[model samples]
Target: MLNNNLTWKTSPCSHSEWSQSDLVRGSRILYSQQWTLITDSNDHKSIRTVLPPGPCVPVSGEVLSGLSGHQLLEIWDRHGLRKCLNLTALNKHGRVYDDAQFGCLSWSECENKLLYVAEKIKNTSIEKHDGESPCRKPQQDRSVYCEDWGESLTNKSVPVICVVNLQSGSISVLQGVPHDVSPGQALWAPSSQSVFLVGWYHEPFRLGLRFCSNQRLSGDNLSVSCPRLSPDGSTLFYLQGRVFGPHNQCLSLQQVHYLYLLVVFRLLCSGFPSSLIFFVFVVASSAGFYDLPDYGSWKLLTVQKDLMVVCCSSPNTPPTLRVGFLPSAGETVTWQTLQQPVMTFDFHWTVLDVTTPPEEDNTHYSGLDFGAVLVKPSRPPIEAKTPLVVFIHGGPHSQFPAEWNCTTAGLAKLGFAVLMVNYRGSTGFGQDSILSLIGQIGSQDVKDVQTAVRTALQRDIALDPNRLAVIGGSHGGFLSCHLVGQYPEFYRACAARNPVINAATLLGTSDIVDCVGIQYSYDQIPTAEALAAMLEKSPITHAAQIKAPVLLMLGGRDRRVSPHQGLELYKALKSRASPVRLLWFPEDGHSLSRVDTQADCFLNTVLWLHQHL
Candidate 1:
């Protein structure tokens, strides 16, 4: 059923994910961003490429560009669309990685060589004769299972560093990387004689590294990444964070100076705070800039000489590009607009500070404060009371900032107030805040959200208390299920996308099994006592108390929280004769991020909430 009073129309702007390939030389800038548009049902839409105005010139006389897809490694001249070389044999070992985590296509200082990461070829084939090429041999067993980095990196494991000589068109894997470690974020050392990369140890086992940054590495007290060398080749700069505890935390800048046969690392600075979730970057002294009052977020695009390009946006504003002139000494920097936002929405948002009252038994949570971003229409749709939607973010460790979010804004445009809760354990607050949520998942996070909602309602906001609903994914989904179950009468409706229902079952089934242990503050090696503890803390324990209608949207192939988790809850709710529904996407993963799947999920959610509320 459709809402007849509401109008539906396609958006005027296109959605895109920017690649980290920004390059600048003289007055020219080069970058690549990708977006998908379903032009027709036949999928025969022509592809187009857009570049900055002027001839397609490389950074230097000739830029070395590379592309890895469809089992092919291609090198181009960047200008004139000339193909320099194609290496089809290399992918026979393993597919080349082009993602931000483990992928790299870096050129050496001399520009004659390129470095990248790829999966190591499995040695599961039996050679017919001695010294036979592994690629030429037939595989005797295809069932030899290999553990990967988990979640979004399902196909990635054992990433090896590979370098290619452009002049000779020859590729070879570099040696001397520790056998027990998986390498990523590779780059050429300033000397160009050696390589630098971050290595994750397979010592105990590999965990999902996608949303997690504090995974235990081989080195103690030192987790490093994004290695950059100084101009003189005698110093190395990188971002360093703790090697233990919560998955997402703040990182600081550190540097290492090189001498003959000796190297010393010293911290340049520490405790750089950010309001953004899981902030990670490398910075210099003058890299700091004032956060413009009107802009929700600003991203540095590229720099050329004394000028830098930046992109800024907010909840209601699309991205706008600006060029800033770098000032010398103490002079103020000046900025000029290069591209204005193409569209705007009739919505407004504010960051609310939510504080919890003192709990005598749990003094750690007493006076604990968090934040939430509320998005609503500029003008209320009805003089009476408008419906409100409480939106919870997934990562118990993630924070929600006042940045542009299409889904949140779309819900607001539909005349519903949206509240994005950053909960107590969310990142950017400090180390103690993150640790506070461990062993206190269900109780602490749930109380904070309920308190935030109560606080929001007490304000002069025109939201209907009787027409309230809840929606979330992953950990947020877990919270959503907990809310409707424990406080069964508060919410009118609920939606959970790939939520965690039973922590005990998740310990055995989830790829990131460590999450269960860390969140519950238990040992990973399961026992009867541990399992009992997990079951007691799960949302399913309160299933009998749930009266609110639940809409469970799950991905069949989710590697994070298995689809079985959602199915179990569906069965529990259905058996009780509750108004429960489940929508399954077989090809989707934990994120349900495919364009078509996302559209269907949100549309169905709107229909479900509208019908029930």
Candidate 2:
């Protein structure tokens, strides 16, 4: 039995030091500073300065000193003044910043570059820079291109590519091979100069790499998550599957013996026609069983060369990351565990952060504390110190389990501390919390997450609140959007994948609306007025208020939330000039399954956070 009164403590097994300051840094920093600051730079005059001094870099080649905190100052310089921008301004004199704007300013060396795949959603032709019209007009069979290009990287054509221009919102299609292929995983190499396209065609999977500069195919082979290039792009590593069975002689002998037994059985039973037939049948069946071959679980398939490292996982295991020489098969191939163990945190039957435990035994979950299980980190302390990622599980009625999820585990492996919150309305804590969600979709449930965040911050101050991100699929996605819109200050970024943005739209589009109506006792579905009221509590209605950068992922075939849910909110946010991004997977339904699609979504998410958050 678990102790009910024990106060929750940070995971005792974790080697990393815990600090409250680290966790509360975002909120505390915001509170400690004066809401406004006025700086005078003309006379080298003094003013409040919490600004760290290091690089004297100018913004747009303009330096704006003596600027007030949380207040935007527009000074005339050759270009623009260099000053930190905030999401909100305290006064009308302050320049209100648009979070949605992807400014022309570049920060780090990698700031301006990103690689993504684009497919044609509508039949519309857009002209290319070369004075050629490559876009196909909307029809049933619109051309979809998979190309590798970013603002910083040069464009290249490949055997397979998809291109979407952010500036024009236009899509282009490019195909290398005539054969039809479904992309399994699309990864932009760390250099952001090339892309690796993985797809499944026929029986075996294949991988192809395309360099952006030349639009040339580097290499391709039969495998899943294969042809992984190193950060430097020197080597490729992949996993291969091989089956071992009976030796040739053994197989041949078994065949011969089975044939002999069939003849003998028939001959022996010949005395009685009916008995002979049955016995012969039994003998043949038994002989056939003996001829069955043996097989084994997928073994680590690794190809090592001087230039690259290639490794792959058995379909049963989660995708694994491997390191080796760049571009060539290396002499050594190292497999790194990409999944963390799941931990279950149960708190007062109201909230839980279900997650995978760390890989090592050094992490322990002694007694039940607040119904929250502390997932231990597998990597070293440096990796464990990565930003915390809280997953808001969907299912207003479902609970996030401590089971292994590709998304959670993948994010964890990408140096993120993942917390899957099973707040009010989640199942498994009993029917109470689940039922509590009926009319309290955004209220109490949201509170559960708020409490969990506080609890987590209490345990580890290093948890960068500024770097914190939330991701949710479906209902969880709804929660994510709602959280950002309602409490934009709490999160740095949000990814609402296949989320339900509008309750009314969901009531209309969901297949389970009829069932929901009966449970909630609403008549004739909520009226448009009632629906609007409910939507007022929805993220879609509040999309304009979200201050953090948001990413919205949608599936064209999703019936539960409807792609319109995402589209409507995305459009609203874009119109309001809120920082927002949208990614639509056309061939996919509600959740992504294709390996390539999954990989692309995951990779893009990490990259997005890396850039903005």
For TM-score, the strongest prediction is: 1
List model 2 lDDT by residue over 163-254, tens digit each. 32333333223333223343323444334433444433311211112110111121232122333444344444433321111000011001
Clashes of each: 0, 72
Compute the lDDT of residue 258 as modeled in candidate 2. 17
lDDT digits (tens) for residues 140-233 of candidate 1:
6445555688888987877877777767766777544555677787776654555666777765566777777556554577676666666566
Stretches > 4 Å off in candidate 1: 1-70, 82-84, 90-92, 124-138, 231-233, 260-288, 302-306, 328-330, 360-362, 516-524
For each candidate in the order shown, give its overall lDDT on alpha carbons.
0.70, 0.44
Q: TM-scores across all candidates?
A: 0.82, 0.41
